[model samples]
Target chain A: MNKQPEKYQVFEKENEILRHSKDVLASPELLSAQAWQQEYERLAQSYAQLLGEVKLLTSVSDRLQNKLNKANENIARKNEELTQTLEMLTRERIGKRATTIVLILAAFFFIVSELVIDPQLQQSAKIFGASGLIVLKVTVAIALKPIEMILENLLLKTAVRKKMS
Target chain B: MENFFLEETSKTPKLSFDVSTGKFLMSGRSIPENSIEFYKPLFEWLDEYVKKPCPKTTFDIKLEYFNTSSSKCLVEIFRRLEKIKDAEIVINWFYEEDDEDMQESGEDFRELIDIPIVMHMIAN
Candidate 1:
């Protein structure tokens, strides 16, 4: 009868030993961490490659932006130059119109001097009148350039003042 | 199908799509003020070409410069070309040897489509 109880205790202890062995097998140590490490490394490599590709694309975009900026600067410079040239040409045109008007008025004066004033002059008057007429022609011819220059300079100053305002 | 030839202009490129040889060429600069209007005829011709495409079609692109709108149109053209099946489609991309941007642009297009693209560097 004492042998029977001892045998049952031994059997139950053997069963408990088997259950403990099963628990050991199911522990976290059986799982390989290296698999997760390898997957992490693979994802890291792909992330690096994507970063490099994005960097290259960003570099290309910056280069193109630099080229576009240079082109815009060139266009602005050319446009400014064209505007200045046009302004100068317009001033010169106005000066030329003034010259034409002055020339026409001088012609009228010459005609009046010749038709009315010249016939009324005596020999003495003729001498002085002729000299005065000659002087008038010379003055008109000499004043043409200075007049145009003055008019253009005035227009330029006015343009400058308007721009400043 | 009849051949399509458009002369190059200051704001456009030269396009010669020969139906007989199936050798399509687009050269020069493409920066038109009106992209849709300028490329309408080309799209029309491509529409007709897709209906009766050549057996072995090829595209040769040699451009010095192109704008954003032109690039989009070019992508659309490639998309249309992609629809053609059972025929070989080869695209040759030409660029200056010193032009890295053009080569990358070709690479970008290659990534976008399935057709084969070959880059040719023109020596100065």
Candidate 2:
């Protein structure tokens, strides 16, 4: 009386057939030729049925696995697309912040040049003149581009670090 | 016979076998931890149903997913239905349009079972 495996425990009909086969095997010479032929045919039919079941089950299982694999691939692709969109949004936000910071800095510099630097340049009108004031304002205007670039890079780095943490 | 209805859960499918209508439905996921235990009542109901089956026995199987054990239980269910000598039995197997795997599974069961299993696609 061989114990059925845990997975095959539910297959009571198949197990019964197996037990009958074992009984037949135990007394091989007792049965006549005609009886033996009948047993052989019965066993053959059972085997065919079991084979059909096995084939169907295997095919279904494989198909389900494939479906799960495809679903996983889709999720992975969607996750990647989401991450790219998020990064783009972060860059756009940082770009706007950088531009605003640069604008404010430019306003502060303009105010200082008018209130503080213009008076200081007045005393040195002999050597510097009004061209000195023009040069100062032009330098400040040219520096805004690099200032904005620096601020954007700094903000981007901070954002990246925050995300990593 | 009383109608047998089991609500669908995370691990098991909904089973609705109306004695009056003879329109049985087994839908949703079927990945129960104990497949045999989960399907025992259905099998018993089917056995009784076969003794005095309805004129038109329509079984609608709209499962999205089922494990191997559930599939075996399904085979048992089909075998029980085969015992009905008089009833006009039809199994309507439904699957999503993009779910070729599920469609192929329906075809596989159609080949194995003696009863007519009509495959229907649910538009994605």
Candidate 3:
């Protein structure tokens, strides 16, 4: 019975204190102060959330900048390589054209010597001794043979180089 | 002696040979698909010209590029020029200032062929 009464008394004391505080806050000024405190707490929470969002956005911006820089560097490197390749190709093309011109001239000379010069020499040789004519023809052939061989070797080398490249 | 003038094509060089004027110029690029076919008529003309040699035969070569096979043809041309005993042959080799390969090519031909050759370097 004593324990039950003590519990009842403590509950009554708490109720009284709550009623007194409510009566004190009945004034408009006091009520406004309470409302301001609640608003300040809400604002603080919102500020914290906004700060977190700003931090996330800053990190994302830094990552994007790094990616863009890497992409630019890669593009620059590729452009340099492409330029070098184009230069090399131009040189090779020029070399090939030069080689072709030389070969055409050689062929022309060979045709002339074989068709016209050889026949004239042969006809003259017939008037002279066969021995002299044969020697002359052989000498001319020998002289021309080296030139022909050199041209053939050069052509072969060019073809091989092109294939290798 | 007849005049042989072959117009320049995409694959061949320009050839202007005049028997009267004795101004034979072979210039531009030469990279023909069939070298023998392209040069046959030119060789025939040269053979005919050799019989009645010109007083002054000036061969101007300003080729930008040629192949190894073409080099042989050049040698043959040089030999023909060398054979003219009664005529004066003046071979002018023109190259670009920055082209070392062309300069060396001129030197090689000069060494191999016995002719009065003049080498001139021009700005490309």
Off by over 4 Å in 3: A1-165
What is the DockQ score, from 0 to 1, of model 1?
0.04
C-alpha lDDT of all candidate models, in order: 0.74, 0.91, 0.70
Error at B89, model 2, angstroms: 1.3
Weakest 10 consecutive residues of candidate 2 chain B by summed lDDT: B97-106
- Calculate each model's fnat, 2 decimals: 0.00, 0.53, 0.00
Evaluate residue A53 in candidate 1 and report its C-alpha lDDT on the 0 to 100 scale.
40
Count of backbone collisions in candidate 3? 17
The TM-score that candidate 1 achieves is 0.48
- Output candidate 2 Cα RMSD: 2.4
- Write the number of the candidate with greater TM-score, choosing between 2 and 3: 2
What fraction of native interface contacts is shared by candidate 3? 0.00
Better of 1 and 3 by DockQ: 1
**Tens digits of per-residue lDDT for model 1 on B1-124?**
6899999998799999998888999999888876666777788788888877899999999987777657656766776788878888899999899877778877777776679999888998
Candidate structures ordered by lDDT, highest first: 2, 1, 3
Report RMSD (Å) for each prediction in the order shown: 19.5, 2.4, 42.3
lDDT of 2 by residue, A94-115 (tens): 9999999999988988899789
lDDT of 3 by residue, A41-152 (tens): 7556555634543453344344445546876999999999998897677556656665566667667767997898868877887788779877875786566546555655
* Order of models, best DockQ first: 2, 1, 3
